[model samples]
Target: MSKTKSPIELYTKEYYAACTLGGIVACGPTHSSVTPLDLIKCRLQVDPTLYRSNTSGIIQILKKEGLGKLFTGVGATCIGYSLQGAGKYGGYELFKRLYSTHLVKDEATAYKYRTSIYLLSSATAEFFADIMLCPFEAIKVKQQTTMPPWCNNVIEGWKKMYAKEGLNGFYKGITPLWCRQIPYTMCKFTSFERIVEAIYARLPTKKSEMSALQQISVSFVGGYMAGILCAIVSHPADVMVSKINNERKVNESMNVALKRIYSRIGFVGLWNGLPVRILMIGTLTSFQWLIYDSFKAYVGLPTSG
Candidate 1:
């Protein structure tokens, strides 16, 4: 039998690629599946008067726009998240290495400050991941927020935005995307690590002795718990991202847009649509970690990598 590699050797360039691919497999399909819920979430944020509660919003959308409307921008969700997954998972692994080697001095320090390392690494990875996701997210929000007679799909939206505002148009919400995703991602990664650590610590048997399904269930629990924090931390900026992307003005800065939105909706409004989001994000994030971990196991790679 071959000898097992150390953690340092286990997470190599190819390991990162596997993690990136696993991220794509995990995030893309799961996010696309929730397009309908996400569509309603955006509508509630952008036009609360019209959309109202989640139940009312769904009924109204089905009645007025039909089934097709609920799936608006799903293509953007899949494609954009697939790309962002590469940046997020792959970059997280890369940043983890950077933090371990350059930032954390020695192994003992690394172990002592692992939580801080997770936070910094997750934040750095999410920053670049959001950059990749921003344009596609802009397209998705625009399609979801604007009613009929808007760009029909991701391709059409890309073309239209290019014609209307050029390359800069696509990146309209990068700032808010960063603001929204960074904190959310930081919470996600850090919480997941801590929760998993907690679980293994509490478990009488070693993780290796647990069944594969048991391991996956633990991952799912950690992910869902993390997602609650993810949604709460990210909701306000998420609202701003949708609003900014759908702006009608010619030259609106982030502050101008934020001020206008805050005036329109106060602190309470920022948390609108959160109940539905809790259900949606909780389930979504759980499945993301489940699928990602499953994928890694299937490919014979370390799940954490």
Candidate 2:
């Protein structure tokens, strides 16, 4: 008789290391490609009057600064996202395993509880990940927006901010970040798990027995659903983060700036560039899952099913 190996046996140090590295690699290009959308999103969030229409904003940016300006903060964004991706994906797997072992008993119970686990794990991971990201995010937002050229890149931005604002500079937008990320990750990870599970449950055959194509299709749908939720829940905070990250302030307090933005933009203004954001999130989430799963399969790790 053949013996079945435990899930613990499947999780090796090497597997985790690979997952971390793979996540970083997978996130780099995705972040770089989405820089333009990010720029637009930030602009609309910071100054709604100036960028009321997404198409008009894009056109204005293109006309004044040209296409290259759209990628203003690509470098910082790439670094931040790569690190965040590694932490998020690796942490999710590690926490999921821990939860399954300690909190859940039966395999069926594990599956039932997976969505909660995913939400908790991903949110926890993102909290720390965003700390690492806060400085770079500040730099990226400043660079992307209509900030002065003195803040040329992340390093310059960091130096200028520290010189002016001390340690507080790097974390200027952390409150909004928490507001954005907690809900965004909650929706992203939980929705993904729920959607995937629902798809498999509705299938005629067991998901474990499905072909690779079937698994990929399920993952795509799940990812899209998760992305959509994330985009909507986090849009306002995202705009706020961008505004705080940018904007050289001589007089206005952060609260004042926020109030100004709110007064100018209103609720719908927060959702500026949502269409592009949807595309970015949908593509990135789908690809991240596909790549991570493929890597896991290649490394002989057990599939989620």
Candidate 3:
């Protein structure tokens, strides 16, 4: 058998661009659509005494604020996610290449070290991404949790926060953002790669010989595994994001607040809006890979394995 040139071998630059664009497009919509679930999750985390249960909190929002209110900060969610996608996917590619050059000396050792590289690269990328995300997240939280109409949009929301609380307002929940994002990105990117590799290895035919359908199926499975793990591992920090973003004040530190939220709500409370989140992550994640690959192909770019 003769060696076939890999997609990445064909058009590296185009492939990288596609990956970045696909990440933005896919994640933007996914994050926006799930804003309501996020709102409910955050509310429960901040004031367990008020929210009590996810179902009840959702119902209450619908009753008082109407269904549209649930999507209050969707615009911010989209913008924030778009930035995050660029940083995440583009940064991953850049860092992956860097690590491959400096860390992995040969194919024999690639598999063993590849996931670790992904974890490190993704976490680093997410740290910067979350900083860009913090202000938007803060505004989104305020808007979602029954803020006044004047504070409806991002600009006004930021103004209001700054006027009242100053620069510290933007960074109020940043610790939680770091906590949630670093682990989430680590699991999301690393696990996706690992799972895809494992599946391809198990296939009857060599991965290089598999059709597009097989590739997509593998992508879906990999994305699901990554999403589930990301969701579970990041739930605690997620609770923190919700709590700090929504509440005016609670006489407790961040860790104390987290413990209180968990103690009041228990394990189930930690996963308050998990059903919607799972659906959100699974569908978007699967489509993200498909879109990224398709876009790369369209642009005559090389595919990254």
Candidate 4:
């Protein structure tokens, strides 16, 4: 008789699916819910002179475009981020596992090298995640910056760009995206890991003794703390991506676009949307970790802090 798979094998597919689904649910709807904030953030980044604050930015958009205008590019934001989440969380797990096998050592040794592993694994995953994100992100930025909004939805935006500018138009900001996302993700995973370790190290009780809710709360704290750093680290390149997509010509080189955007506003302008970004990213990252780790545990996989 054929031997049955072990317990881990019994739910392997289901558990892995949950890993990806957790990230999708965590990031996609959360990002869509913050569409107004993101829309304002983008405007502040590209045209700070026009928008002095979030409140004023919303008022301007409403007066000029209407309430529906606030949701421009939200569809692309959701779909694109869902794809990115899958690549990020799924790829992180894949690369981390692969690297762990090579770095095989005692638990203490692993902890000693934790930060390096986290950084390298995060960078690998983000590379794949950015590939999924760039096209949709390009579409979203175009829609957000275009007068009266560029297209009705992601599909329309993609179609219009493909017809007009071809494939190159959809990925013009990929380089800046990597520049922004790589550091952001590295800080995200590493800081979250370290923060969680610090928080737990002081606890009277062990992690295994804590209830699931308590574990999730710990993850929230770490993820939020990490996210603040993530926003700060990534803001400059975030500005570059926004400015590049908004003002770049059909055949314009990224270097020329970068020089022009920076020349007009200079270095300080790159941080225009930082406060709003901190709030948005902090909460988003916290919940994403809470949901992602909770799902991993529920599906019988190893949990992280």
**Clash number for every model?**
0, 0, 3, 0
Q: How well does candidate 3 score on lDDT at residue 38?
A: 71
Better of 3 and 4 by lDDT: 4
Whole-model lDDT values for every prediction? 0.84, 0.73, 0.73, 0.84
| Per-residue lDDT of model 4, residues 1-305, tens digit only | 11233245423456556667877877788788888888988878877787888889889889988999988889999999999998888777667766765785766776678788889998999999999999999999988876778899888899998999898988889999999999999899889989999999999988878777788889989999999999999999998889888888888888888888889989898898999899889988888898887776665555575
TM-scores for all candidates: the values are: 0.94, 0.84, 0.83, 0.92
Stretches of candidate 3 exceeding 4 Å from the true structure: 1-15, 47-63, 147-150, 248-271, 302-305
Mark the regions of model 4 whose C-alpha exceeds 4 Å error after superposition.
Answer: 1-15, 104-107
The alpha-carbon root-mean-square deviation between model 3 and the true structure, to one decimal in Å, is 3.8
lDDT of 1: 0.84
Across 1-305, the per-residue lDDT of candidate 1 in tens digits comes to: 11244333456777788888888898899999999899988888877787667788788888998978879999999999988888887788789888988986799999899999999999999998888898899899988888783788888999999999999898878888898889989998999989998988899987777666678888989999989989988988888888778873557877888888788888888887788788788888899999988877666655551
Cα shift from native, residue 243, model 4 (Å): 0.6
**lDDT per residue, candidate 2, 29-135, as tens digits?**
77788787777766666665667556787788889878878788888888888888788777767777787788888889988877777877778877877887777
What is the TM-score of candidate 3?
Answer: 0.83
lDDT of 3 by residue, 1-305 (tens): 12345445522675566667866876777778777777776555555566656677678878988988877788888988888887787778777777767788876686677878888888888888888888888888777665443377888888898998888888888898899889988988888888888887888987667655566667767777778778778877786677667763634466776666567768766666566566556666666766665555454453345
Which runs of model 2 end up more than 4 angstroms from their true locations? 1-9, 51-56, 105-108, 147-150, 247-269, 302-305
RMSD of each: 2.4, 3.6, 3.8, 3.8
